[model samples]
Each structure stands twice: as C-alpha cells, then as structure tokens.
Target chain A: MIRLKVALAMAAGIAAISSAPAFAAKAKSEEKADAAPIAIPAPPPGKGQIVFFRPGGMGFALGCSVNENGEKISSLGAGRYFILVTEPGTHQYSVKSEAKDTLGLLVESDETQFAKCKIKMGIVAGRPDIQPATEEEFRKQKSLKLVDEDDMGPAPGALRPAEIAAALAQAPAAE
Target chain B: MLAIFVATILSAAAVEAAAPESDGVSSADATEMVLSASLPEGGKAPLSDDPESARRDITIPKLTPISIQILKPLGSKLSKTGETFPIRLAAPILVNGVEAVPAGTEGMGEVIHAKKSGGMGAAGELVVTARYLDVDGRQLPLRSLHWAQSGQSRVDTVNTLNVASAASPLPIGLVGFFIGGGQINVAEGALADAKTAADFSIALPQVSSQQAGTGQELSEGDLAVPSGAVPDEAVDTESAAADVHQGGKE
Candidate 1:
C-alpha cells in the first residue's frame, strides 16, 4: 500500500511538474534560452490541401493533401510530411499500414488493378527490406502471392514495437 | 531507396546546441515548439534536409560504443563465480546537457529468483534493463495517451545551426531482456565521472520476499515478487577482475 502510494505520489508530482506555474515559467525561460533558428514549414499553396492521418494509436490519419477531385494526397505542404511526388492524374487514396510507417498516394488514371502505394510499411515482394504498402503495391502483393494485411488489431499480448513503408515513393525529395 | 537512405543514418551525431549566452523564450513557446514543431518522421528516423530536422537530431553522438551487456547473477549470495570488468558507459542522460534524473531514479535491473536460468543456456538467468536515451532527452511515454493539440497551438519547426547550438540530451529508459550467467560491466549507479572504466558496475533490482501485492509474475504471468525492492548483495570488488572477464565470456 505504501509503495503504491509512493508511486502514485511520484506520478502526481510529475504531473504537477508538467503543469506547475513555476515549472512552466522555468520551461518557458529555458525555451527562450534554448531557442534555435528553425525552418518553419512553407505555407500551403492555395491550390492543394495538406492532410494528416492522426499519428499512432487508435487515431491513424496521415493528413495528406487533398487533390482538386477531393482525393487525399500529400504534396506541396511542408512539415514532416511524407511522399516524394504523385502523378499528375487524379488519384483516390486510403491507408494500408503494414507495421507502423504511413504515406500518401497518386494513382494512374483509370488503371485500377494495382497502380501505386503510399504508406509507411509493406513488403517489397522480391525485395527483402520491408517497406510501406500503397494501393498499387497491395495489388502487386496480391498478384505476387504475398499475404494480405489483416487490418485487424494485433493478437492479444503481441509485442508492439511500434510500427512500416512504400510507393509513388522512391524516397525523400529535396526542393 | 529513400527508406534505406534514412535508415543509413545509423551513425553520425549532431553537435549539441550551445547554451544561451542569452535566455529569452518562455516555456510556452518552448512547449509549443517542442510539441508543435513537426518532428521528422520516425522516432529513429534520419535527420532530414530541413534545418529543423537537423537541429532536432542534434545529439551527443550516442547509440555507438554503448553496447548492451547481459550479466549473470552471482551463484550464491555468500559466494560467487565469474569475472567482472569495466565497460565504458555513455554519459548519464542530460536534457540539453543538464543532469535531471536524481539518484535512485534507476531501481536496479529486474531480479529473477529461484527457478533455473531464463537467459542464454547454462548462464544463470536474470533480465537486464539498460537505461538509454534515444528520444532527444525527452522520455516518450510507453503507454499511449491522448496529447490533445486542439487546445494547444502546434508549431513544428526544426533549426539547424553550427555545432554551438545543439543541446545535450537526457537518459531515457531501459529495455529488459533475459540473460543468464552474465554480469553487467557498467559503473555503479551510473555515476557521472571522468570517462574512466573504474566508474562501472552492474546491479539488478531485488524482489521483496513477501511477494508483489499485484500478484504479477516476473514475466507476463510467470513468477511474482513483493511490492517493494530487495537489497542487493554487497558488490564484490575482490572478484572484480575475474567477474569482468568471466561476465564478458558468459
């Protein structure tokens, strides 16, 4: 009982430390002292809307850019956003998480069997290193006899290390 | 390709931000920046081309030389077997080069009692949870909790500057793994000292004899110990050399 009380007390103290006015003051002062020159994300162009899928946990949305057709894409907008560049054609998208990483997508017009993927984790098929799966890659995996993602929660007691990869995705781009 | 490129950032430490010859920003801005500024993707992700990403990556080059060590428990409290040696330790954690984790912040490594070894074969069994700092001095939560940004204005920015601007970091937590017959080769209590090997030791936490109130086992539903901690044996320096050497092999 005492240990529990102590643990609880410590937790409360940490909570107080996180919110106390004095601590806040110190953190604020420290923030000023520690401030470094940073590059704020360039503002969004009037044309495209950047999107965000909630990071981790029950919330999962990358919050990519919205295309003219109201399709979600990741582009132009800055701020730790993913994706290199998408095709010019209109694209519809959703997310397929393999392990943990997430991404955005661009599709080739009218070619739907499996065109491209934009996610954080997926199998590369013949490729060994794990990558994110885009819609296209999903199709490719389907085509190549790879297992489909369960889309369900992990089994009870599974070791969740944090979690994934992929396409319309060669890598990070520089402007 | 880019994924591999980023993962390739296995090495390379960002020089720390120098402490202010001046102090100005308030914690609000600091919290806002820390919370809002976009964190480059990936907890272990690489530093991006963005200066902000680079600035965030600024760390005292760690994750190297800090090899994880697994030590076997002493055969019996009264007597023992094995060699003990000194292993270099990464600096005790610092948030912006400041030491914050007070003494006893670390309760020794987890203790495994009775039942035969659970570690590598033959090696007696015990689990070692080496505390480390990978998450920019800040300890990210283990359990997921809602960090509502709705009320908080978010500002995600990274600042890259010459070596002078990077700040030191804090020691994060440790991960536990089962290893038997091995002895940790670190300095005692992870005391801060001149980077000398003498400042090392491995001590595991002691489990109370009365049994943990929660009725939980050591591993998930395995064995149970009391709620409070057990007192560790008087560290034996007499066996230090042999312990270090044997601990290295076993």
Candidate 2:
C-alpha cells in the first residue's frame, strides 16, 4: 500500500511540474485582460482633439519629445499614444529625436486629428517624424493599448492651459 | 528484502540510461556548467575576438562612393585653395542594393590645391576634394578628389557673347559682361557644377555598442578614416584634367 502511495505522489509531482508553465502563461493573459482600455475624452467647447501616436519602430525604446506651438506636451515612446485637446487654431507640432521634425496643422472645431509618428534611421541613432494620419490608418490603431501616464514623463506636466500660456510667453518668436 | 532492493536499483539504472544524450554532457550537467561559468564571469561570458564574431558584432556596411557633379564651376581665377564649396550628387548612393542617399543631395567640397593662372601659361591647377555629404540632415563624411584645369569652366561664353552683342549699343554693360565672363559671381556661398575626380567609397564607422542607447549623437571620432587605405580606382585624374583643359581652351 505504501509503495503504491509513493508512486502516485511521484506522478502527481511530475504532472504539477509540467503544468506550471501553462499556469504562468494563463496568469499573464489574465493580467493583460485586466488592463484598462483606452478611453477617448470628449473635447471641450470650441476645442478639438489632437492625437499623436507611434505605431512601431526599429528602436522601440527610444522616446521622442513632442512639442505643440513650442511648448512640450509629451515624450512618446514607440507603440504609444498621447492625446491633447486644444482650442481650434493653427498649431505647430514638433518631434525632437536626433533632430527636430515639425508639422503645422489647422485644427478645426469639433474634429479629431491624428498624427502618425514613425522612427527612421539617422546617422547617429533614430529620428522621429510626425505626419498626418488617414482615417483608415487611425482606425487600425484603435485596438492598441494607450501609453501609461507614468511613462509620459515631465513634459506632460506642462500640458495645462496656463502652463502653455506661460511657456509661450517665454518662448522666442519663430524665425 | 535483497530482491526488492536489487529491483529498485535496476529500475533506477534503466531510467538513467533512458535519459536523452546531450552531445557529451547531460542536459542537467550542461545547465549547471553554464550557470557556474556565468556566475564567475559576472553573468556574461567575455566575447570572443575571432574574426567571424567581430564581423558579426561590429561590421558596418561599406557605402558606395557617390558620384558628385559640381553645380558651381570651380576656376583657378575665382576659386582659392582651402575654399569650401557646395556640390550635388550625380547619382544616388546605394548600400547592399538599397538606396541610402538620393541623387541631388547637397555635398561640401574643399579646394585642397589651387594655383591661379600665372604668366607663362602654367596651366592653372585646381584640385578639389569632397569632404562630406549632407544626408537626411546628417553630415556623412565622403572622400573623393577632383583635379581640373581652367578649361572646364562651365561659363556660357556663347550666352555672354550674345549679351555682349545685344549690349554693344550700351558700351558700359558690354565691359561688365566681359569682366565677369568665366568667373562664378553669384554670391559668397553658391553651388557650382563640377566633375568628380575619382570614385570614392564612403567608409562609415561601425556604430558603437554603447551608442545603442536612446538619443545618442554620432560623434566626430566615429568618422575617422582607417590608416593605410588604398584609394578607389574610379578616380581618373587624366580625364578630369583633359576635360578642364578642353573647357579652358573654349
């Protein structure tokens, strides 16, 4: 009887060892499922939404600083997105990686604009470029997870309307 | 009791023998050896200095020397030694069959050697060497030497003649055209078309492993050329001189 019991215990241990990896994978999937979905906030009166997103890059870890009208709004990493609600006007957006790439947009009221950011090989490392995103391209990225607030860095801290005004006041005129 | 003990020993031996062979060392033994080796070496083995490993790790693709045509013509009378001028690539630069730099990319060249036309017809010598190419907002070092005589001047003598004939009624304007003839006089900084002296191979330095981090800029040290390198054969100083002589005679 004791010999049979020992054999059963050994078999049980082997089975447990084999199933451990599957259990760990299940746990990871559960954690991913628990992550909150990205929510798009409604634009304020007379303001529109400007979304800057990087779908992918060769150097995925490189973060680029994104500035709106000379005021930095966020540092976006590859496969991450940042949304800003701003008053309708022409805003100058710049992405600074190895060099600065700027784009000007005439934002209209009650409309959402999407900018797709891509990383290109530079002489040193990688450079970031911001281009207008088509509706189809923007729709394809809807399922992507939004970047976490912690990874947004100190640039996002200056996104307030008063802070933007203060920064613009101190900024030199564009030559 | 002895029979049971022998049976147990036989079963254990059979199980051990059934374990799969892993080359020479058993799987467990190999794992243990790797772990121990890693621990003593600070969790990473020293990289091998073999040629294959070095090539795999640090090999940078050789950039084909681009053909540059001078936009602003260089002349001994106007161009001085050590003067920097702008140039344009005649053809795109390809690396591993992919276009790395497009045609018409602006480049900068330095007048390495120049001698103005002196009395006795010394055949004014001008040797210009390409310094670097402005690619995608980055300055990539390029090396090519072009030698020319005053004959290759792109100055449209016919056009000047036409202007001179048209302005003959105005003697003051005719003198201005004659004086400015065969001279590049747009401004201090201008691009003139010139010919490439030799085919140059662009040698980009290997990207350092440390610079793999985010936001690293290419430093000057990365562009140092290797010593004792042979020049590319595509340079035809004879042809360049002949073209210049032919232009000077015109």
Candidate 3:
C-alpha cells in the first residue's frame, strides 16, 4: 500500500510539469492574436525649391523648380500653373533666353503633393555683389542665413518703393 | 483572463506595426515648403463680346522690369478771345506692359498708353500686358501666362483710367489700358485743341526719389499706410521642419 501511494504522487508531479509550457505558450499566442490595432494618420503636402539666379542681378533674369502649381498658381498670372509636386526625387531644369542662360537640378519630396512656384525673373548684370544662386549656393544660403544683405545703402536685394519709383523715373526707354 | 490580455497585447502590437506607413517616403516628415512667385498672364487672350471675332482676342507679352514716371500737363481749348473752355471728346493712350499710376503720381492720364493690336497705335480700345517673377528672381516659362495687377482700376470709364495686364504661368509680358473714346478737341478759334500729354522721365532703381522731387508728391500722410504699396510675397518653404526636430541630426 505504501509503495503504491508513493508511485501515484510521483505520477501526479510528472503530469503537472509536462502541462505548464503548453498552457503558457497557448495563453501568449492568444493574447498576441487579440491585441488592439494602432491608428495611422495621412501624409503631408509637398513643397518647392529655388534652383538658379543670375550672376549680376539687375534688370531681368530666370530660375527653375519642381515646387508649386494649380489654378491661381500665380496671382500675378491668373491661369493654371503648377510646380512638380512629388516625392524627394531629382529632376532636370534649364534656362536659355536672348538675354541670358542657366541650368540646375530640382529635388522634390515624395511624402506630399507639390504645386507650381512663382519663378523669379533673372535680373540683368550691373550690380557688383549680385551673384547667381545655384543649388549648391542655395545650400550654403540656408546655413549662413543672410536674410537680406543690409551692408549696402538700402541693403543688397532690397528695393524700397521710392527706389522702385525712382527706377521708374530713370528707366531708359525700351531697347 | 491572462490569455485574453496577452492576446490583446499581441494584436495591438501587430496593428501598430501595420500602421505609420501612410507615406512610403524615407523623409516623409520633411518640412512643408511653399514655392510661390509672381508670374505673367500669357497663353490665350480672353474671349470678348465682339461678333465678327468669336474670341474677344487679347494678346499679352511679357514686359521686362522697367519703370517710368508719368506726368500729365492739363492744357485747354480757347475761344477767339483766348478764354479757356472745356473740350468734349478725349482719347486714351495704349501700350504693352505699362501699369496705371498709383496715388500721388503726377496727374490723370499720366503717360497713358494702351492698345492690344501691337501697342504702337490705338484701335479705339485699351489693352495691358505684364510679366511675373518670384522674390528670388526666377521667371515663369513663356508658355505659362495668367494675370497680373498694375495697381489700377479697370471699371472707371469716363474720368479715372487704370489697368493691369493679364498674365499666366509664364512672364510673357504686360500691356496696360488707358483713356479712350474721342479726341479732346478745341473750340473753333482759341487754343486749337486741349491735348493731354505727360512730361515725365524714366529712371533706374538706383535714382533717389528725394533728389527727383518725388517726396513732394508722396502724400506722406496717406502713403505711410501700406494699403497702396506693392505686396511682398514669401519664398518657397524648405522641407522637413518636423523631421529635422526629430531623428534628423542637428
């Protein structure tokens, strides 16, 4: 009788040990399967970049981009105009006119949509400090952060209304 | 209960993993850049009400950045005794890309000029043209033209004449409208005819308005207000301000 009782106790211990891992794994897997989902938001919009500028900024010049676009894209030009709105990708651009010439690259964003940008008319040559703005140069511009060079009279690139009017007063007849 | 909890957590984790992929772009969180610039109105002319021509044909070319001060010297007609008299008819000048003068500019019909049909002479109508440029000096393509403003009024027919050229995406050019209708005729005898002409000069951005007596007419009281001044637009926004703040390096 004593031997039988001992044997039964041993058998019960073995059964308990074998069942533990299976139960634990089942519980874990079930929890994983029932977990709640996470919420995700929508993507953002795209943007534009300035590609080029004239060497001697003065009368007129040119530039390029894959930035802005759409209806009323240009308030100045009320028509359907837009910049290339795309992911962060590279594009080719150029400028060639009777007065001047230029070339550059455009990097766009992939996450959002882009629109047509208002192209800056390349200015002619006259000013000494006026230099063309290239993609590489623009990169430096972002770093140094010269909002508008104010060392000069009204400051470089800064045109006062009176000055504009004066330019008007002194504007030579059409070429 | 524990099983249920564990299952819920696992499911939640899976869901989280599936989400956050709305943008496949690596720099999805980049800054929002807005590239806005002023442009010209070109391409096709607006349709008019003329029957002979289905399109109210208007052609605009991109005008360069040039400035001119308009001066109007009002002259009158006279009788045999040399007495001043009001003339009945008056005609407007026409040209391409010339905007209307803002307040404080010399006088009405100051260097007035406009004509759609080539701009050299008047076709008994007013026309305008202009170009658009960005703050950075980039220009729109010649193909994309829309509309542009010249700080002028278009509705006033009889007395006040102000007009801006319509533009498109490209800075084709601008031509403006002026006074029209009939010529200002003088009475049978006195001062032949009361002609309207502006005696103004053109200058570059370098000229000093003060030296040119522009201050005298500036109406400081009214001009100080920005209501009439040209608007300054912001440049295009750069990318990823948000991301830069996060995982991006300093």
Candidate 4:
C-alpha cells in the first residue's frame, strides 16, 4: 500500500511538471489575443492618403509636432501614426523641434503615401526626421498605434473661423 | 518512502517553475493574439491595403551615372540658405546602361549657402546641394554631393569686359560691353541650364547572398570598385587610367 501511494504521488508530480509549460504558453497567447484592434481610415474619394508613422524609438515618451503648410496637424508620439487626407497636389510637410526638417511631397490623386518619422539627438532634446517610407517598411512596424483624439494637441496659434475659412478656400479642390 | 515522494514532488515543482516562458514572439503576432480572441468567430480584422505594385515597365539598370539638370535655377534673388527647390534630369539616367529616371523626372535640391551681390565688386555666391532623385515614384535620397557656382564667374567676366571696353576707342564698344554685362547678370539662370556640371554616380550594394563564392568579400579597409563606373565611351583617358590603377590594387 505504501509503494502504491508513493507511485501515485510521483506520477502526479510528473504530470504537473509536464503540463506547466503548456499552460503558461496558453496564458501568454491569450494575453496577446486580448490586445485592442487598430482601425485604419480610408482615403476620401479623389483625395490622397498620407500616413505619418513613427515606429521604434529609443525615446519612447518623446513627441514632436507635425505641421502641414504651417498649420499644426498633430503631435506624433513614438510608435504612433497619424493619417491625413487631402486633395492631390504639392504639400509641404514639416516636423518641428529644436530645428525644423521639411519634406516636399507631390501627392497624386487616389494614391496612398507613407512617411516614417524618426527621432535623433538634438542640442536640447530629440529632433524629428520625416522621410518617405515604402509600403513594406510601414507594414513591418507591428506595434504602431493610431493617435487618439484626446492625445492630439490643438493647432498652434489657433486660427480664427475666418482664417480657417480663407485657408480652406485657398486649398485646391478635391476630386 | 514518504520523504522520497515529497522530494520527487518538490523537484517536479522546481522544473515547472524553471521552464522558459514565451517571451520572444513578434509584436504583430502578439497584437493579433490579443485582439483575435475578442473578434467574432470567423470574423477577421482588415489590414491596410498593400501599396500598388511598382510599375514593371521601367527596368532598373545595373550601375550608371545619372545626369541631372537644374530646372528651377538657384540664385541670390530667389534662393536663400537652407531653402529647398526643384530640379529635373537633363537626360534620362541609365542604370546598367538602361534608362532608370526618365528625362524631366522631378528631383529636389537645397541651397546650402547664398549671398546677394555686396558692394565693392563683391560677387553674389550660391552653393546648392542635391537632395533626392524622384525615380519612378520613389524618392531616392542622394548619397553623393554636387555643387555649382554662378555669380562669381559672371562677375569676373563683367570686370574683364569693362576694362577691355575702357581701353577701346569706339563708343559702340562700351555700349556692347554693358549689354554683355547685362547678359552676364542673366547668366546665373543660363549657366545652370546650359552647363552639364553635375553628375551622380551611385554604387549599388552587392546582395550578400549573391556575393557568396565570388571571392569579392570586402573587409572594412578594402576599397571596392564603384558599381556605377561611367562607361568607357563616357570616361576620359585620365579617369580610365585611375580606374585601372584602383582595380589593380583591389
């Protein structure tokens, strides 16, 4: 009877040892499956879509303001993306920090453009660099989250209603 | 016996605790795993549409010097330091002897330095840098440097003509000289348009897998041949000789 009891206990221990890894793996996988889904917005008809995304960054908490034609679009954080839909034409994109770096993009109608933002060491803090990104490059960044509305900063030097109307009036017509 | 059984149970518990956890999974998979369980059964989240396939009509040449032209002329009046401007290829850029960037394909240039004409015969100065070549919908950041001067040469030529006219007997000579000087003033735009002073020869990196067994493995100190060596027809004798010397050393 003593021998039988010992055997049962040993068998129970072996079973527990064998099953632990499997349980742990399942739990981890379950944790991952619980992450929130990202929603990507579609480009409006006859307009182009520009996605400004920052992938991996050493300074994860650092952020910089992005401006389009001198109007502040959003403050982009690390591992985040912002989307802008505009009429296809020439657009000046700039990232503002200790100094500003600018890129001239000729947006084509009905096309999607991807720009990657990176942070570099600056005199005061990190400066942002925006560059054209290939589709494959953008897709490979798996952790890129969409910037939420609350996280977006208000447009700098907030334009009055008339100024906003004038600016929109001057903008090219969307197809 | 009970003591042995207890020891066995403890050993098993230790082994279970020591087993490695799943820590190295890709972020994409992890994200999918987190969201997938909440998704309705058999329903899938949408992915961003893939970019349009690169136009296959244009073939990439192996290695060739790309010739570009300044479309929008840079001068003291129009360009300021750190200002960006547009440019175009004067001729189609060939890669491996094939057309890569067609003529008139838009490119970007920057004025690194610019100064308007100061008093005391001080000529205007301008230094321009090429930024990128927009090739077939791709903006390839330039890895090479190209610079050109305009105002100084025009200034020198004007001074030479003025001195020559002053020494001449005819009044018509002075009038002609002034007109020529005016032409020189306009020459800033013309020089950039007419002169073929800038050429970019880029070296394409050899794919590591393709380089296997080629005896072309290069170390940090080894200077490899420029992939975009100008064709023999295009290179002068001196340049060809230099290439030969470099090749021999390699």
Candidate achieving the largest TM-score: 4
For model 3, the superposed segments whose C-alpha errors exceed 4 Å read: A1-90, A99-136, A139-175, B1-250
Candidate 4, residues A1-175, lDDT tens digits: the string is 9999999999999999999999999988876664434344444456666777887644456776778767787767878776676676557778887767665555544556676666644435555655555455666876676666666546332232343345446653222
lDDT of 2 by residue, B1-250 (tens): 9999999999999887665443586444544443343332233233234422222111113334456766666665677766888877777665444344578888787765454532211123444566677764656665423232232221223334434755677633233222321222223333333332233333233223332223233222222112211112221223323322332233
Residue range B1-250, candidate 4, lDDT tens digits: 9999999999999886554335565443443343333233343222213222111132343223455566666665567767887766667665434344568777787765554543223334455655677754666554223242324322334334445655877533233223211101222222232222224333333222222122343321122112222121112323323433443343
Candidate 1: where are CA atoms >4 Å away?
A: A1-175, B1-90, B102-106, B112-123, B130-250
- Distance from true position, residue B72, model 3, in Å? 68
Give the distance in Å from residue B247's predicted Cα in candidate 3 to where it truly belongs: 25
True contacts kept of each: 0.00, 0.00, 0.00, 0.00
For residue B60, model 1's alpha carbon misses the true position, in angstroms, by 15
Interface RMSD of each: 20.5, 24.5, 17.8, 17.4
Q: State the weakest 10-residue window (summed lDDT) of model 3 chain A.
A: A70-79
Question: Per-model C-alpha lDDT, please?
Answer: 0.25, 0.51, 0.24, 0.51
TM-score rank order: 4, 2, 1, 3
For residue A100, give model 1's deviation from the true position in Å. 37
Per-residue lDDT tens digits for candidate 3, residues B1-250, read 9999999999999987665455453442323311111111331122223323221111123332222222221221111111222221222212222222221222111111121211211112111111111111322211111111111112222111111121345433222223322212212222111222222222111112122223334221111111111112221112213322231221
RMSD of 3: 38.2
